[model samples]
Target: MNTKGHCCPKYVILQAVYFKLRFTLSYRDVEEIMKIRGVIVDHATIQRWVYKFMPFIEAEMKNRKARVGKSWRMDETYIKVKGIWCYLYRAVDKSGNTVDFLLTRKRQRMSAQSFLIKAIINNYRPRVINIDKSGSNTAAIKVYNRRSFSKIKIRVLSHL
Candidate 1:
């Protein structure tokens, strides 16, 4: 594949993408790091590289089959994006393998239901789902169980 671009080498572009993703660094931070390595590049260029390479990376990742466990731990947390608060729902298996994640604007039952549905569909049905004592999550699980034939056990943890 043509990894090299007109202005930067493939290694430099991949380094910027790796820095931006593997760490919580901004595009400007990645640019600064590349500059420290004597590679002059703009933050916008780095952003473009990330946007361009992400789809290919995701496709490569999806090609690999994941061996996730049957017991899953689900939770939701608030994240700020562009100064706006959003909810991030995440699920991990018993071995701490990432099952799935969904970002949404609302923290209601519908949001929880959608997140669970997506997780289940993507990672396959789990035997047991552990969650916090959230009423929305509980209600969403109930709704999911009612609609789906494969019933999953829900375990509410007092502290997550």
Candidate 2:
């Protein structure tokens, strides 16, 4: 909070954190912008704030008092990490809020299992999972004791 390079210490640091969250901007860019606004904080300080706050943000996102609804839409998106295509799995609850997410390179049994494990462990497990019609999903359902909708009401999903 000793950010006294002509910048109001708290405002500059708070703006840097807010900007980083709202937009995927680099720490240095955020630092420069704060400097332009008459605030002077190092990029490393911004990085530290983000690193410390990210977990709390994720936890708040995951542990809402409302469990949303039973219907869950699960999907995988492709993103480049280190120039490699990484599969990011995500889910939206019935209320259309993001529930959980996972990132992995392999779309195999282990990846699916880990995603499900996290979802189940951290929050309410969706009663219905609407994932793509893929072999991995098929195996995942089996591995996690999920069944077709006509089967188990607690862990039913699409017949893929």
**Model 1 alpha-carbon miss at residue 52, Å:** 0.8
Off by over 4 Å in 1: 59-66, 75-90, 96-107, 130-135, 146-150, 153-160
- For model 1, which pairs clash? none
Q: What local lDDT does model 2 show for residue 60?
A: 67
The Cα local distance difference test for each model comes to 0.87, 0.71
lDDT, model 1, position 38:
99
**Cα-based lDDT at residue 49, candidate 2:** 73
| Stretches of candidate 2 exceeding 4 Å from the true structure | 1-11, 57-67, 75-88, 95-97, 101-103, 130-133, 146-160
Clashing residue pairs in all predictions, respectively, total 0, 1
Candidate 1: count the clashes: 0
Question: After TM-score superposition, what is the CA distance of residue 43 in candidate 1 from its true location, in Å?
Answer: 2.5
Candidate 2 achieves a global lDDT of: 0.71
Weakest 10 consecutive residues, lDDT, candidate 2?
Answer: 147-156
Q: RMSD of each candidate? A: 4.5, 5.7
Model 1, 75-143: lDDT tens digits are: 999999899999998999999999999888889999999999998877688899999998888888889
